[model samples]
Target: MTQTVSIADLMSLSGVTFGTSGARGLVSAMTDRICFAYTCGFLQHLENIGQFAPGSHVAIAGDLRPSSSRIMAACAAAIHHKGGHVDFCGFVPSPAVAAYGFARGIASLMVTGSHIPDDRNGIKFNRNDGEVLKSDELGIRAQNITLPDLFDDEDMLGEPTPLGPLIDVATAYVARYVDAFGTEALRGLRLGIYEHSAVGRDILVRLVEQLGGEAYRLGRSETFIPVDTEAVRPEDQALARQWTSELNLDAILSTDGDSDRPLLADESGTWIRGDILGILCARALGIKAVATPVSCNSAAELSGLFDTVSRTRIGSPFVIEAMNNLINAGQVTVCGYEANGGFLLGAEVRLENTRLSALPTRDAVLPILAALVDARRQDVSLSMLQRQLPARYTFSERLQNYPTAQSRALIAHLEAGSEAEILARLTATFGGIAGEVDGIDLTDGLRIHFAGGDIIHLRPSGNAPELRCYTESDTSERSVANNAKALEVVRDLVIG
Candidate 1:
């Protein structure tokens, strides 16, 4: 047919739009035609920027979701149609194929919806260097792709050519850690790998044993299980406690689908909050400068470990951008982590005998190993080690199905006037919970500081039509309580 498709029009028509991590949509909406056109637009934009060339190679991988394989095949077909070869690093973590593509100076893609349910899927794109930034996304949206007549009227491909030979990226992924931390990093630790359909399940279990840890595989599942690291599921919470006690384990570890964000629980079976775990991991790595989201707990600055702290919007791209700025400003030993617990190394780190190289993308294994090895070196439980940081507990929850336009309106109402007027309005909004407002920050969201030191932050989700609220207090119970109360207030304000 040789049809010319506008990326923006396709996104709106197919309901598959780009998010913080990738282009995600319902499985029904992500047809072969949409996926193929999206991939073409991505490659075309990269070529325009000189990051991709004709006949270059591209790597592809995916999670264990049933829909991922089909979506990945469409992406591979697009690569071949665009004169690029498919490396086909099948069924690997997002970070693994990204590393391979970066090392080989080629573009890459991962077909996964991250922590979202299996009804949805996504394709995460990366350049030769790192993930596609906001500018790259804009470039892709502005691009026009030529579509072939291979797809049916229903936008489905009829058995596209099979992907190429599988490249073993997991071995190199495992070696990345082993080479940096040695084989005996966790010689005396007992760990649990919760293998609930994560693409890297076997790889994580193998890596744990290879690093000298007694590893147990728990809850292995044939079905795709969506695990969100930020908000631990109630059943998963119970499972971690039971696993720790039954296995006499020191810690339990897992990650979200595609194995990018980390999920770690202490000996008490209590899942460590991702932001808190991030602080401990940064400290263990001797990070001198840190870039984190504004919604993350303020423990990074409170710990007094880093020479500089950069607070950014709630996404990896923003954190990466801030990290690059820190490096450009002459600060070394830089790193970044998300509230979801994915850690990014911004520069090389020199340990006593080994050095860890910079990998700017979010990684699950690095922070998991860092925490385990640091705990061993300190001869303390993960709980005790966490207590060494400042006393702050945070809770986050989101109002699903909330309209993004309404969420923006709420924030705008709170920030609609001069400084004093805004303070007066905020006091009116939050005075029932705590006494007057102490201060407010408009960075990425509406964050309010109360007179009594409690904090409330509200922001719209970048990946979905939802409103998220974060509350921080001196104790975990209070933090959770405050969050519930804040959401109640939000509901009352909006629904009424």
Candidate 2:
């Protein structure tokens, strides 16, 4: 008799754990059996919740990572074995598959690690309504799922079996924009797309052309590139400047591997922080209420633009939950965004004769297109539009491979003392730049406000093994300088 394996068993044996957005683990640790078990477990949980039925369809997609296809095939097989049909969305953006699934009122799964290194991969699950929240993850973990040992061998699933997408998700996603904003919405803009293996690369270029913009395609890589929007690499910054100067583009747009987190650069090739981009996009759409994570720049409040601003932990599901709460409270025109520049529309919106349906998941194209169209309509440069907001600037960086326990310990040490005591300790460790502690917030992490009007937030990354630091200041230069100094101080503290 073949023995059955439970989801918890697989998770324990393979060390695959749920992160900020999904179940992520190293590719080597995520064997075909593990992926299959997880997928089956997710489906079982959905069925229990009345979200899945026999012969129901599940949309699936993946990124450009080398292992994505193999893992995706395993997921497909699991769905097939569970009596569900598959709508293979192919290599599309995470939002593309999600939007398609939600429209058809079916569950979906995406195989990608987002901005993480190619060695790691993840599976993001979505319900027919929206993204699976923390509660859903808990339920999925509690599910009693079983799979046979036939999926244990790695060699059995070494090669990818290409699956055709049932629907043209790319076209539908593009139409969601062009129809709302019109084909000539960006007519005078010259945009450059840094297409470095993002699944949405070609789609983004085509969208720009369809919107009557002059599209200059740049940086098409056959290999996967882990482009973290929150922690923009120094080399990518230089490349943006080079591309902008050489092409004389009005703006440059790109996204992380899965195309959920956006990267937007001004005409000068200076990349704008994701939080600031979120603020601009919200204001562009005339959003009255907003939900964002605590790590975001406080300019959303400082600008006095939105009627309500709710801050949650550093994750989309948290933000989405908060947004839903606002909606339930009778506040319409609700939206949410992450510091990674992914925007979510919490309600249906109509612009002129076009109506855009709600997509309450992280989306790169919406924010990128909205910001560009807003700038064009205002007849101002993207930089000028940014300047119109409150002068608060923020910078973020991560200490790679830092242990989460160590990060928590350091924060706990400071948080245990009084304000003056904590200030003394911070000044001693971080040098005089720490100044005096004006206030401290432990909402999602340790966020410190200094008398000198600078803010430093330290938190362990929820998705990867790293310690992330965010700094805000009255000026852009100071924010950048303080960010670098804070990371250096933390590195020295950990090493020394």
Candidate 3:
């Protein structure tokens, strides 16, 4: 028996929704059938767009989460059902599988939850050329798929078949760096790799060793540890410092769950902000034009590093869209980055007979490598190299479990209110921390600019039920203080 299912309806029923990247939800809600149906819709939509065909190959990969393999199996089953070939690129970084798929002009899926906890998971979809943009997501949501009777009544598939033959992408992924920067890119540097169950742990080690750096592996965990680059846990912060000082390392590197977002700490073991890392990486590559989320540190513009700075909504799809515009506007060198330190190169960088091809997706490896190379070239420590940038600093934190509806209602309440009413509400909450609102931006969320140059921006988390708060100030101390103060006020506004 076959049943017609609307993807949009399934999204509501399953509680899995598309976020800044892909469809994410609690693992318990992502039954085998749910994942299968979602994949079918994804494939069918791609087929309609001519990015997929009956006999086309679909690359699949995943992170180290305990539930990821099961999700990948369900996704593979959908590919087989759709009369497509499955190229299982098992247990790799999100970018690795996408790169393989792009090289072959095939679509791909990555089973991951990124920086979220292991109890949650997600599927990141990619078209042949690159990530599935917002329009592609809309097409997928509009799919009315006919799901075959392949599961039990509870929407669970029994005993998934094995995903055959693993495809190795390690060599090519590492080669992408070595070919451009040479095998001795990090020669004479002792780098520490904090491998906390990220799927790309071993691959990162291989990359370091291949680049002629002495790689020190630390904190290799079997249990799933969700290391969010945006919010480095306090324990992880202490651990970085301990390892760097105890081992006398030049720098330390790590990535989030699927390894798209990078975490880099300086010699003193203080983690570098992602946007700060982006500035250094762009400088290393001599990027001319750049696109970044508005939540990123304003120093990206204040530093005067790039010729053009395009600030978009806080998502890679938006950044990619802006990056495309930069390219179309005839900017010779182009790139983009997120507040999470995931760097995206929009154009191939050719410098002095060395060419590095562009992979316009969030990539952890490029920033790690670029920062290392830049620091080495300048004969300065990563911390010293950072000091050269402008002083603007940014910080972000979130109140988890805040209902999405309430978050939207809070923002909408203020936006719909008159100027004085909005100011009264804002000042009632944040008046002590910052003065009256000087400006407001409703681009993606509620961004309030204070008369004192402080900023407080609030938006609902894309994937999870969380209310995110971002703050910016001229000094790091003020930035951190503002973030803490803002979150406290936001909590009261949304919950109180």
Candidate 4:
């Protein structure tokens, strides 16, 4: 007799591990059975919501990981089993999938590990309108469907027909960059690109060269480089330092494995934080209304220039929702990018008579191209532009193994108390409260703002099992010190 797998058992598979932006895990762990069931379930939910139109094409894409193709094949098979047509756009960036979905007016999914090791892979799903929400995950999980085992002959029955080459996607995306900032602006710019297992390496090189810039390819690694632009550790920094010294280029540009997150280094080989890059890109784009995460430093720099500045929870979905609201209300001309430097332009909404609006998703390519254009226009170095921005120190740290329930409880406790009361209580226990915010914005976590422009926000990471602490101040020293102190206080409260 064939054994049946419980829904809970499928969900608990080791392949459902944390990724920089979404779920990822080992290919073997993410069994073909689980992949088919989850994807079919997700599609069923979409159909119930009237999201899946009959004969409406769904764009499918994958990264360069060894297992990515297998996952994509499984996902496509699942879609086919559900009577949905799949348009396979093989080996592309996550943003390209999003763009293809929007442009073609169809739902899509990109199979990728996205900067994780080659041993792992996963999928990012997008509705025709935008990304799948947190609520959608629950609905998808509630879906229960059985499929044949990987070793069974039935596993090969639902093979999907591959869509022809995505030349149009590549052509249109590249053309958008060329049109936005003519080739003249990129003249004489030199970039050292670390093509270390990034899917966008070749496309990025072509992009720079097409716009009259030079690109030097370096370090093509066979193994995946799990580089997070936001959380570059000391060892990654060391690698970057060595590469920059060896190349002696104007800058070094790269992205996470699937090219969803961008990383940039200055001429002197200093890796600029994503938040700083966001500010520079916003200024370059001449956007007056900027929306970014509360964790970013751009608000302080573009305060005077922007008409409306809004802060959201740290995710592209939040930023996109805020941007949509502003667009609908006619409150802003352009939406600002987050610290990760994924610029989503409102103008990109129209292409080939179709209203292709800015996708409410994170993309690494847009901001980098925008910054390059800005640098050429101003005849200044990328680092120089960054230095000219208003100085606001932003520091982020995460405490791993901190239970989400405990973190939520602490946030609730802090929120229930008044600022004065909370400060008083903190002082009575651990010394004095250095600052506070306008009533701990409990929308996502415990965010306290002080009168001196100091801020600390604590929340559990959505993509990881860690509790994250974000602090901002007028100076880097104060930001670091305050973050350390706040983390210590929180730790003592939880552990003691």
Candidate 5:
């Protein structure tokens, strides 16, 4: 019999902990043993919950990060040791692996750090049904998992070579959209794909071509690139403009490292905010109910496009849970998305004989494809379709290496006193441009609403040591300016 181990002890030794997205930590901190232990713990939890059985198949995939392969191998070893077989999905998007595995009622895992820097990495676990929720995390942590050191002298792991890919998950994912939307869904649309280092870069291009659109692959990189859809780099913005003029493209599309959160630009190279993209996607699919995180823009509520809108904390699992609740309440057409443009379909719907199955997880492809298709059907530019929404814009940025504890301290200080006192304290840094503090929402973070409809929300990134600030205004310029101002103030506060 295998020696039993404490899951909490392994986490403490590895310094890896659960975040809003997954279990993330520095690469140096995540040794092979740590990864193996965590995998075993996750498996043991699933077994306890009857989600897994001995000799069952567990699919795995990874992103383009250098350390991903090694970590994936360790996870494969863990699966084999736990009496499960590994069906390597190769390098693919997180959603693709999840889609294939969830369809077969099997578990899956993705080794990725998302848009975080190369120094960090993470593992996202998915149950047979969908993403692992907070309760699942607790169950995993509570499992007693033991690991024996195979290499006693050196810090290394047993090499558990993964089996070959069982099937082409990428192709299957592509077929999902092409079959639903038809082969000529995006016919005559010229699109640019910022390949970068996203795992789904090639698949995205293939999908465009399969839909009868022209795809121009740009910015392909051999090295891992951290492309945060939330905080797009200045160079990327400039490149989108240059590409638009040169290619005369209808739009530019891309995603982060794992390709779950999308970055979409209009014909003029203007990047549309992800929440706006979510609204457009829902409208395109004719969804009647939408579930999104509190960090998303209020445009969804103001648009009146959906019969029901539910707001949850900032995470896919929360959105999925909310969407499931709506579905259980007898809503046939339900969907969910994040501010990063990751969409989730919660129900099977038929549109003129095209039936789409529910995919209740963050997916970059669905939103990008939906937005482009919607624009084509309307015979309008992507920018024009965006203009139909309410006149609200959002901007976000982050201060890297900022401690989460410090962020909480600052929030506690600001939220400590009465409304008048809080106003005086905040106005000292923000000035009167923010107007008076109308209200404060502490849903997942500290969100402050001003009397003039300007809003500023501050929160620590769940996966990284960073302080994130989000601002919204009636005009795009104001939103952009306020984000910068808020970051500057946050920087000063940290330094002081």
Candidate 6:
């Protein structure tokens, strides 16, 4: 007789841990059993709300991890057993799943841990329109799920359906880039791509070549490497330096695991933060209306290029919400994305005739493509273009180990205090107050603005146990330093 795992035991699996972004844990901890039950529950909830129509077709995609395929199969099987037709997209970027969902008029399930380790895996669910919200997750969890036996081999397995011929999604995506800025604009530029483990590697190389620019591919990794564009450690810097030296390249570009986050390196071999890239991309696109996360660097507004600036809570879902509102209200023509520098074009804001209608999710291809074209058009280097932007320092740091309850309480306490009194108290303790912005935003988290273009936004990771604190300023050095100091002050008050 095969042993059965209890629901409590399944939930204890390592993959069950929630992060600020999504659910993620080790594959062993997130067993096939857990995936099936969670998927069943999620689908049932969709059925209840009429989100999952009878015979509705859904798209499934995964990353390059060894376990991704298995998890994708498991989730697809669950959907199939429930009478939903599955259109498998195979291994692709996270945003591609979102784009497919929007384009094909079906919901999407992406199996990826994003920038996490190879041993870890997670799932991101998108409705027919976009990513599922927190409220949706709550509804799914409340649904009654009949957990299947882990060892019940016959009943648990579903028919294996092969995905049709590999779709050249990258080709379609590249065309969108060309449409945004003419191909003639990027002529005669030399670009390098660090393929590593990113799914967008070949696509990025092809994009540059098609644009009439010389392109080189480097640093291809065999193992599933997790690359975080926002937090580049010394090792990543070293690798980038070696690639620059060997390729004699003008710029180096790459993306994280699923290619939703973009990474860029200057000729000098220094990695540019995502927030800085967002500001630069906005300038290159020449858009006056913009919306970004509160955690983003304040340099966006300091550029003096934008006519309307709106700040939302972290996460693309929230950013997309703001973008949709702007589109509906006719306040902006374009939307800007800064979650690690990957910009979502017309698709993000959903324009009818623009190049973005083809893709409505975050993509690493567009910003780099546009920026390269801009550089060639102006006859300037990538770094030179970045330097032309306004000088502002922005720094971000996180305090781990703070309980969710405690973090919320601390934000509530800060908000309840008078703005003047709180500023004076913080100034007295941390030195002097530069400025202050009153009110708390519960949409994503708590964001407090200080005078002189410095900002501190505090929130618990929706998917994890850690707390995230984002800071920004005018100079790079000051931004990094201030972020450290601000995190220290906040940590003391919250934990102590």
TM for every model, in the order presented, reads: 0.97, 0.96, 0.98, 0.84, 0.97, 0.84
Residue 279 CA displacement from its true place in model 6, Å:
2.8
- Compare the candidates by TM-score and give the number of the best one: 3
Worst 10 residues of 4 by lDDT: 347-356
Residue 136 of model 5: what lDDT?
94
Tens digit of lDDT per residue, candidate 1, span 198-262?
A: 88889899899889888999999999898988777889999999999988999998999999999
Candidate 5, superposed: residue stretches over 4 Å from native: 1-4, 151-154, 158-160, 418-420, 494-496
Whole-model lDDT for model 2 versus the true structure? Answer: 0.88
- By TM-score, is 2 or 4 better? 2
The TM-score of candidate 4 is 0.84
**Which candidate, 2 or 6, has the higher TM-score?**
2
Range of the 10 consecutive residues with the lowest summed lDDT in candidate 1: 487-496
Candidate 5 residue-wise lDDT, 1-496, digit = tens: 2466787777777778888778999998887777888898899989998989899999999999999998998888889888999989999999999999999999999999999988999999999999999899999899887776553334466455666655678889999999988889889988999999999999999999999999999999999989999999999999999999999999999999999999999999988889999999999889989999888989999999999999998988799889989988999899999888899888887766688898888899988988898889889999999999999999889988888888878788777788788777776656655877767788888888887899999988899889888899999999989988888877777522
Candidate with the larger TM-score of 3 and 4: 3
- Runs off by more than 4 Å, candidate 3: 494-496
Model 3: per-residue lDDT, tens digit, 1-496? Answer: 9999999999999899899989999999999989999999999999998888889999999999999989999999999999999998999999999999989999999999999999999999999998988999999999998988889977888879578899998779889988888887899999999999988999889999989899999999999998989888999999999999999999998999899999999999999999999999999899989999988888888888888999999899899899999999999899999999999999999855589988999999999999998888789999999899987788888888888998888888777768878877777668789887767888879888889999999999897888888888888888889889888776766433
Output the TM-score of candidate 6. 0.84
Task: Encode model 2's per-residue lDDT on 1-496: one tens digit a residue.
Answer: 3456667767777878788888999999877777887888899889989999889999999999999988999888889879999998889999999999999999999999999999999999999999999999888787776665464346245444445545678899889899999999989889999999898999999999999999999999999888999999888999999999998899999999999999999999999899999999889888899999998999999999999999999999899999999999998799999999999999987676777788999999989988899999889999998999999989998999987788888778767767778767776766567577767788988888887888999998887789999999998888888888998887777521
Q: Model 1: what TM-score?
A: 0.97
Per-candidate clashes, comma-separated: 0, 0, 0, 8, 2, 21
lDDT of 4 by residue, 1-496 (tens): 2344444457675437333354556676666666776677778778878888556677888888887777777787778767888787767778877887887768888888775556667878787877776566666666666665443543342443344455446666676566666666578977888788888888788888888888888878876676656556677677777877777777888888888788888877777777777767666656666778777774444447677777887777677777777777785466657666666564443222333346567778777876767776678887787767777867777776786677777776765556678765544533354643333455567666666677787887655446888877788788878888888888888422
lDDT of each: 0.90, 0.88, 0.90, 0.70, 0.89, 0.69
